[model samples]
Target: MSNNHGFARIYEQGDQVNYGRSNVANEERHHTRNAEGYRPKDQNKAMNQMLEENIQDDVAERYKHDPTYRATMHGNEPSKGAKIDAEIQREEEELLRRKQEKTDSLPGKKQ
Candidate 1:
């Protein structure tokens, strides 16, 4: 029968039909349904802490292996904190310049 064939087709394609809608269903099944709408405080804390630890370890490893990074960290070769401060100042100035350029590129701005 035609109706029987349609039901069989639906049964065969059920998994594919539900695949695209499974993410929200999976999240609802796995996560707590919080009505308060507030984010879980410690949800991202562990990830952020792990990332920070990894970054520190990488920086330490770089300082050990790379001469330029060692100099920046230890303030050994380029006159201590002055070089670091100058580098930060230069970066800030560069960022400001880029921002100004973006603003200038916008329409209806009188140069």
Candidate 2:
């Protein structure tokens, strides 16, 4: 068997690799290039926008149908509710961190 370098054997001995021609079709090239001065379209952005719209629709429907939920979610109450939710989330995260620390301190576990 012949010892092969990283180069493709299909090319003749003196054939030059054409760096200029990407071989990507014009249509594909257009799709790959983002517009000048603009960021590339994020795959996750579309999904996130759809998710946000769905969540907003769900929340609006709930506000229309449920008196208690609507009352709690409105202006001043929402702020209070958000504060409580944030506090609860922080406490839960702290508890999780403590548990992780305890587990990490255990014998036979690598830190």
Q: Residue by residue across 1-111, what tens digits does model 2's lDDT show?
A: 443543342235655233222322322343443222232233223233334455788898876644456656654455566556657767888999999999999999975
The alpha-carbon deviation from the true structure for residue 2 of candidate 2, after best TM-score superposition, in angstroms, is 67
Error of 2 at 37 (Å): 12
How close is every model to the real structure, measured as TM-score? Answer: 0.31, 0.31
What's the number of clashes in each of the models?
0, 0
Q: For candidate 2, report its TM-score.
A: 0.31
Per-residue lDDT tens digits of candidate 1, residues 4-111? 322232233343122223333343353444212323333233233334455778898876544456666676675556566667767888999999999999999997
Q: After superposition, how far is residue 87 of candidate 2 from its true place, in Å?
A: 0.5
Q: Which candidate wins on lDDT?
A: 1
